[model samples]
Target chain A: MSTGLIFAGTGAILFAMGVAGVMLLAHLLRRILAFNLMGSGAFLILIGLAQRAGLVDPVPQAMVLTGIVVSVAATALALALTRRLHKLTGAYTLPATRDD
Target chain B: MTEFFDPLAWLILLPLFWASGAFLLGPTRGARLAIVGVAAQLWLAIDLAVKVGDGGTAIRHAVGGWGAPLGIDLIADGLAAAMLLLTHMVALPLLLYARGYFAADASVARYFWPLSGFLLAGLNALFLAADLFNLYVTLEIVGLAAVGLVAAGGNATQIAAGLRYLFATLIGSGMYLLGVALIYGAYGTVSIATLTPLINASAASAVWIAAALMLLGLMLKTALFPFHYWLPPAHGGAPAPVSALLSALVVKASFYLILRLWLGPFAPLTGTIAWLPALLGSAAILWGSWQAIRAVRLKMLVAYSTIAQLGYLFLIFPLLGPDGLALQAGGMQVVAHGLAKAAMFAAAGAMIHVTGRDAVADVAGVASRMPVSLFAFALAGVTLMGLPPSGGFLAKWLLIDAALTQGQWWLVAVIIAGGLLAAIYVFRVLRQAFLVPAQGERRHLSHRAPPLLEWTAFTLAAASVLLGLRGVDLLRLLAVGSGP
Candidate 1:
């Protein structure tokens, strides 16, 4: 396979896995990690797309830089919220069946 | 030529600038600054709307004097302007209502002002951005700020709900960013204006995949049916004004983004899956209203009604052909729902404040106790139920006409059923307030809402009705920059 194709394919597979994990797992921490995995997979696709020529595409690089900052902020916020949730409920996984 | 510098950018920047100042000055002073800032932003919004509506041209601005493909740009078309006007109009009253609603809670009020401004900035930025990546960034800001606002309620329920909202929105943004990456890889640009023609020429697979990915992400953010589980709790748990803003403004911003993208770059490719969102929307209407009918809490009922109202906007997606008339129909639906829902939430907040509980049964006899607030609720309900002489009626009329012209009888049935369901839930609230208590069982709350709070909600409800009375001008304004 071409290098770009292989890399893009890997990103796609990782994204699918991350999505499945986020949806299936009830653990909040695991869900956060799955989000990170999703972000990393997306980052990989951006990097792979940028490698189309000898020189990387600067636009996607710029976007990836911004994306990294956003992802970091999101992870931090998710962590903060998770901690708060744990403190409030005394456990991480949502209480059995009471959404309200 | 003035080199194309547009003041439309200030509609976003002023709120952001003031938001920064508000954050620095603290919440009380920040709230005062927000008042001045939102007022200035409203002035700017109206000025831009008048000019754009009159000139019949979009106002485009390139930040830092850099053009597209290399630097970001902002465009204020008729649709974005309509949303801007709606935000400013609704925000000002909500801000005023909040000033009184949280008058005693100094702690929550402190961060509330800045977060609200930041959310408004994020919204205006989302509507005005001309690029996909920029839209993603603004969406992130909107999501984070909304979570912060929802969390501002500070209870365990609110915080947990906010966290769930944050998770859902973050995933949505991640998926949206992936689509942006794919589009850039295929077309070498992320600018919406640039991608319009290129998207039409690109291979069908790449285009369809990107469109599907992006629309999926936006739908999650929009809380369309299956993904709508996070919205009610988050919205219901937030303080009244925050609930109003979240339901009225934030969710609509994401929907507007979907409208902008589909009508702009993906317009040529929308013929394939037009029925999908319509089907989902039909389901959301049926399901959301059914849930609203059974909702025990007042805020949860309003939140579920928001889900149902949002479905109306999506139903016309399949009907939006080259005529672009259905777009105006959708736009009108947005304005109708935004105003009515804001008034409903604000009034509900006032009632729940005095009652000291959110359960529908808890609000019995509050109708005569808080006549102004109950009147506001009933008036907003009139608009929400698509009754005549209200914006909801005009919007529904236009929507039904569109569906009729397109011969979508199933959607027509959904539209009618949606109105009936809305009527049931709305009167459910009113019934609790007005009908539950028998004669001589009348009562009054020891803690009555200030007249300012009552008037604010009434004004918004009145505006929704008055908007219908002048539907021509609003439709004309929406059509200005929406060229075929």
Candidate 2:
């Protein structure tokens, strides 16, 4: 396959894997990791598409870069709060049930 | 070059400028500043509306002075301007309500105000954004601010819920970005205006794939039907005002984007696949209503009602054709629901904060104790149930009319049934408030909650009633600059 097709296929695989990981992973942090994985795959597809068009537009690149930073920031904050929850309860907490 | 002042920029900058001021002054000073900020922004929103009303359609500030596809652009169509006005108006009362509401810590006062301003800024930016990528960035800013607000509660459940919300939002954003990439690759540009002219049946496979991915991503973000798993916990679990904002305005912003895409870039492709959202919408209406009916917590019931109401939004898709009457109904539903539901959530917050309980059974004798709050809640419920002289009634009237006119009476049936379901849940609260229970003595409360919060809820609920009167003008605005 051509490089564009190869990259697109790889992106699709990564997307699938990320989705499956989100479903399979029991831990909140792992699910977050899966989310990032899906995000990276999306970026990869965008990059692959840019390369396919044969002109490296700075716009999509800039957007993806911004996306990466945002994902990291959100993940960091989520991780911090999750850690706090674990510390508080001595158990890895999910969402509160209706019983609460 | 400058015939008139570009009013759209004010829509964006007013809140942003205020946010910076709020940040500079710190939280206590910032809280005071937020009041002024929201007021100023509301004034600017009014100004934009007036200009748009007179000029027919407001389009200004071509990014870098270039046209579509070549550079970014900002256009304030009637729908956008109206939404801007609504958001600013809502934000004004909400900021007033926020003042002194959080007495737990001074840090909360600080963190919350700046984030609210930022949220306003991001919302304004999202409404006015012309390009997909630009919309994505603005959404991120909005999303992060929202997550911060969710986490600001400083409780374990709240934090855990915020984390879940954060993860879901991140995934949605990522998916949206991927869709943008696909569109950019296919069309060689990401501008909505540019794509509107270019997108057609002959468009590349990538375009169709992009549309699907984008819709899927948005559906997840908007919490439509099967994807609505994220909404109840997040909206129900957040603090009262935060829940109010999330249910009222934040989710509406993304839904607005979906409407934009449907009307703009994806108009031609509707007949081929428009059934998708309609089908999903039917499910949402039924499923959301079912869930709401069963929810024990007041907030959860309202949250699920939001999911069901969103279904009404999607019903417009299959109905809009040459005359586009159905599309107009959808627009009205957007405004009506936004007003009514926001009012309901805010009133619920006020009630919960007062009584310290969310269970329906626990709210006995609240109506006598907090008459204004209870009255506000009932008034908002009137709109939700599609009672007369309310925006919800007008919207449903339009929708049912369209359904009958098109011979698609099933949608009409769904709407009627959904409204009935809404009445069931709403009356559940009302009955609990009004009916005297056996156990409790009448306790007259000393500390009446802030008058501003009560006024805010009443004003919002009243707006839903008012929207019915002004529906004609808003509908006219929605029609501007868009071809049937």
Candidate 3:
């Protein structure tokens, strides 16, 4: 396979791994890390696709750039929330038994 | 460029300008400036509405004077302009209410106004963005600002709720990015309009997977049914105005994107995707209503109600397919639910402030003590119940009619059942607040609330009721892109 296709396939596999990690993992922090991996994989795939197409489209690349910023913001906020929740009720895991 | 003359341009800039000024003002001044900022935004929103009505459509500047497929485009068709109007109008009152509520908390002041401005800018920009990637940027601005606002409370429960909200949104945005990337790989473009014509290959695994991933991501962010675990606690725990904004507009922003894409660029994909949204929406309605009925606290109950009410918006998808009564009803339900639910959350916020209690039973005698707020709550409840002279009622009526017209009996059953369940819970709060309070020993409010807070709630509730009468106008606003 060409380098571009290899990178795209690798990114896709990483994206799937991230989704699976989130689904299977019990730890919130790990799940967060999985989410980051998923996002990074997506960025890689976008760049790989642009390269394969033989042109750099600013649109998708810019979107990935913006997504990185948002992911960090969301992660920081989640971490802060995690710290606060631990302080309040002393429970770390999400309460899986939803009444509804 | 004369494109700057587009009123939509100001709608975008007004909030950004406010964010800049709010940051410079800092904390104490920021709060006042935030209120002023929302007021100005509200006015601009109104102006945009009028201009759209006259012109039939609205589109503003291209970022660098390049057209679509090159540089970004920011356009506000009737649907977007209406959303913008609703958002700013809701923000205006909530900010005023927040001014009074957050007056004493000094530390949070630094982040509140600027973050709120950022949130508003994100919301407006998201509504106007003409490209998928541009929409992504706007989503981040909103996500960060909102998470900041949630954690600003700095309590353990608030923080936990914020964290859950963050995880869900992050995973959601991640899924969204992946989908966008896949579409770009296949189609070589990211503008939604450009992707519209490229939506072929229905049997293709990559295409279906991308669509599914995107839908799931949006569903999680929108807090539809099974994915809604994070919503109730976080919204219930946040400061009242923040809760109101989150419930009223923020969640709706993501849903609006789902709507924009589903109806606009992804129109062809609807045949495959419509069933899932409709199914998830049904589940959300039943499950959400069940939770609302059993909720202990008034705020949590309202939060659950939001989950159910949001589901009502999804019912439009299956009905929106063909041009028929079902399609019209589905479209009308969107605006109806938006107005009614926002009113409900604002009213719930006001109640919490006046009574200083979160429990439903403790709401006793609130009607007698705070007549205006209570009246507002009841009016909002009427809307929720789909009773006459309320937008909620009209939306439901249209939805039910559409369900019947489309022969979707299950949806009809769910809609009616959900409406009945809604009435039960709404009355539960109403009876506890107004009548039960009379039977019990009357308790005085421990604190006096500022008049502005009460008025803000009352006006929002009144607007919801007024929306029922003015359904024609609101529906017209939504008509910019899709016709009834």
Candidate 4:
């Protein structure tokens, strides 16, 4: 019933949804979004579960900050790659494996 | 703070320092700096290994004078030092080879130096990290840097492969972060030294879940079969030197984390699940070798062969016992595979460079024109096939001995079968190289490979074979500070 528990529950749900989205979705942009959602969910769990006992912990908070920065870098890299792929192939999804 | 003199710190800082310097100096100027930086790293690695070997314990340095539980720590045990030594040894020659390989392409070289520097920095940091959160951060650094290197080629296939690689790496690290969070929530500490005694077989369900999550994440990153779909394209599609780095060193970084965890904090939880990785490893050997045998492209064959070689590293997990034979086998496999794979990829790059083609069919009669590269490839193939007087052979000998002592008959069978399967793929490439081209088909002599490229590849391949003769020293080093 505590707030921290509630946040943790929502995080678990978000993580599941994100994983499913990543697996089922083929569009590159949507996959990136799904990846972000997964990051957010993990961050939420990190903060929420640390505070589940009603004690404030700065360690997980610090970790979440670091995680956010890393996620942003990854997101930017993914987006840049997606942009280049789109420009070259004119497709949002990856093409099927070609016979070389 | 006196630990500032520690070589472990320099093993990491030297790479970052040169990486930044290289980025500022531009593409054509970084090669010398990178070579010098890696050479310094090699010396430092040797120094740390000697220290650890003589001291009979791990060297621990707490950053900023803050000890574990409140601050980060770096520990260089025998395993870490061995890996560091291998990293620098492999990287030094590869840097030289890359200088020749990328001589004509400034655009790729521009990013290649900084990215590879960052990659090496991340790898050293990952090896020395003594905590879960630190490991996660280092993993991200290594992953992102690798993806950037893959994408540096700036073509459709390379970019697409890079993107897929980026997604897989992100997911892998994301899952690892979740595991770290769960561990923190359960134990309030992330330091490996502190958590070692706290995590037991009877720990709470959260600890179990965390172990599963962490193991799965690392497995994905290591490209242990079934999760290997992202690896071949990323490794195969990149430029030659880039492919060499990715296949030879990058994947092994994640596998090192897995081995570290299994030996340290997760030791108690590994009893029931020890067979899982080995089972998957057996599958990888069979599947990966089959794929390599069927691969059309030369680099793809080498890349797929990397997957098969990596599977051998996992086979030791099931045979782990008090004698530490399996551990020695794992270490030997890692170093041997690293040296041979680097040589193989570098040689493949040279062949492709000369022929201006990537297909296996295009390499016909390359032996007559490029004897040095072909000899390098065949020597590396000798190691890959686990022939006598090669490090691969010694590693397999130890692994089979361990399995026999443990009475694990199936593992013995898998090891032998894997070796035979490896022979098929290796000879397939060699056979193609020795064959004459079809009549009237003109040989495409697109470009000549520099002597530097051929010599570097040969050096690495020769080192791999030489290790089999002098492997006792490495085994002695591996024995330091390795126990409960």
Identify the CAPRI category of the predicted complex in candidate 4: medium
Question: What pairs collide in candidate 1?
Answer: none
| DockQ metric for all predictions | 0.61, 0.58, 0.58, 0.73
Q: What are the per-residue Cα lDDT tens digits for candidate 3 across B1-484?
A: 5666555666667778877888888877778777777887788788888878777866566765687867778887777877888887778877877787777776776677887888898999998898877777787778778877877787766676676677677778778878777777777777877777778646357666677777788888899988988888778878877788888888888888888777766676667557778888889998888889999988889889999988888888888755545444544555556555666676676777766677888778777667777777778788777888887777888788777877889988888898899999998988887677434333644565577777788888887778788888767766665542
Order the numbered candidates by DockQ, best leading: 4, 1, 2, 3
Q: After superposition, how far is residue B323 of candidate 4 from its true place, in Å?
A: 0.8
Cα lDDT, all candidates = 0.86, 0.80, 0.76, 0.90
Q: In order, what are the TM-scores of chain A for the candidates?
A: 0.87, 0.82, 0.84, 0.93
Worst 10 residues of 1 chain B by lDDT: B438-447
- Best lDDT goes to which candidate? 4
Per-residue CA lDDT of model 2 for A1-100, tens digit only, reads: 6676677778878887887776567687788788778878888887777775455677667768877887787778778877877876666647445631
**Residue B186 in candidate 2 has what lDDT?**
80
**In model 3, which regions exceed 4 Å deviation?**
A23-28, A53-60, A79-100, B201-203, B322-331, B438-446
The lowest-lDDT stretch of 10 consecutive residues in candidate 2 chain B is B438-447
- Any residue pairs clashing in model 2, and if so which? none
Q: Estimate each model's TM-score.
A: 0.96, 0.94, 0.93, 0.98
Candidate 3 on A1-100: residue-level lDDT in tens? Answer: 6677787888989988887876677777887788778878888888777675466566666766777776787677666666666667677666543343
lDDT of 1 at B165: 89
**Residue B225, candidate 3: alpha-carbon lDDT:** 82
lDDT of 1 by residue, B1-484 (tens): 3544356667778889988898899877888889988988888889888888888888888887887878888888888888999999999999989988888898888779889988999999998898999999999999999999998867778778887788789878888988887888787888887888776634668667888889999999999988998899888889999999999999999999898888889888787789999999999999999999998888999989999999998998899976766888898989989999999999999988887878888888887779999998998999989999999999999888899998999998999999999999998988877888722422534678888789999999999888899888778888877764
